[model samples]
Target: MVKEALGFNILRAKVVTFKYQTVENMSVVKEKIIQEIESIQDEEMLNNIHHVLQNIYSKKSIIILNDEQKVKIAQAEKDYLEGRFYTTDTLFEEIING
Candidate 1:
């Protein structure tokens, strides 16, 4: 039913589609980036990329706990799973009453 006849054909119908590319995981993306970096021959660009990476890594802080701390954390987790930990309301009540 074409009233104004803008560009419609009642007898013919067509459908169009486009396919997009996708990456499966971080490993594939990381490998692609590494391959691109290896292909670059510009010394200045490589130095700039290296400096940026160094700065990014330097800003991160890592915590290394001793064995005793690890054991305490594991025990706390076990206590939680075994219903040995107190609820937030209970702790808050004790804090306020004390």
Candidate 2:
């Protein structure tokens, strides 16, 4: 029983480690992609990449807002047009000071 428990614990540890490593690997991949994008000088290649990214983004499921959410969004838009919104910097300053 002791040996079996030890084996199970080892397997669980491996699974946990694998999950963490996958997340870390994804971060590394994202960083590499950013670096590659920054280093690319070809405008055509950049445009192609942008087009592919846009297509990927466009395929995502569209959000269907409820009536309450739609009303809130409309109010927010009205406020924006009336210049009732704080700048991001001002918002962050208020948050930090508070």
Candidate 3:
């Protein structure tokens, strides 16, 4: 537990997480950001932030992909469940010796 100090005594803890947002709250968030940016006196700093944001926004989102065919993948999964899959060193030895 996360304890905080009260008068030389440990108090209660609180937890926070980021899963609260849904699709309906976009406009309120945008309005607050716009108000914050307008309140900023340095337009140059805002433009720099905008440039970096655009670069990050425009990049392709990353995804990890498995190269195995679906049938082979399923078979390998079954082998794993049945304790029959190979280790990395065994696979390397097979490749080197074969």
Candidate 4:
């Protein structure tokens, strides 16, 4: 199996090769990285890696809502504040009886 992370193609196998480095096992890569990190004393390099990892793992995105969507969301919030929502049982009963 192969997985793509960022732009790197990760091969899930006993032996994986990337560029000039040969990793013995994909499962041990994390351990190897941890060991390397533990031995590294360079603050600048570690900080760079920290920032890179943050960007790679971050899931935040900006969602631009249109006027109609904004209005709908505002109406929904108002309805919820005024106790205008239906209970699950009532909604199911109405659906079944209809």
Runs in model 2 with CA error above 4 Å? 60-98
TM-score of each: 0.36, 0.52, 0.33, 0.37
| Residue 53 lDDT, candidate 4, scale 0-100 | 80
How well is each residue in 1-98 modelled by candidate 4, as lDDT tens digits?
23355235434332244522544355479888899999989998898777778767788644546689999999999999999999999999999998
Query: Given candidate 3, what's the lDDT at residue 66?
Result: 46
Q: Which stretches of candidate 1 lie over 4 Å from their true place?
A: 1-24, 60-98
Sorting all predicted structures by lDDT, with the top scorer first, yields 2, 4, 1, 3
lDDT of 2 at 43: 100
Single out the weakest 10-residue window by summed lDDT for candidate 4. 6-15
How high is the CA lDDT of each candidate model?
0.74, 0.92, 0.67, 0.75
Better of 1 and 3 by lDDT: 1
Better of 1 and 2 by lDDT: 2
Looking at candidate 2, the ten consecutive residues that score lowest on lDDT are: 58-67
For model 3, how does the per-residue alpha-carbon lDDT over 1-98 read when each residue is reduced to its tens digit? 23434523421222112223433367678888899988989987787667767767877643323456666778888999999978899999999999
Across 17-36, the per-residue lDDT of candidate 1 in tens digits comes to: 11112334566799999999
Give model 4's clash tally.
0
Q: Candidate 3: where is the Cα deviation over 4 Å?
A: 1-21, 60-98
Scored by lDDT, the top model is 2
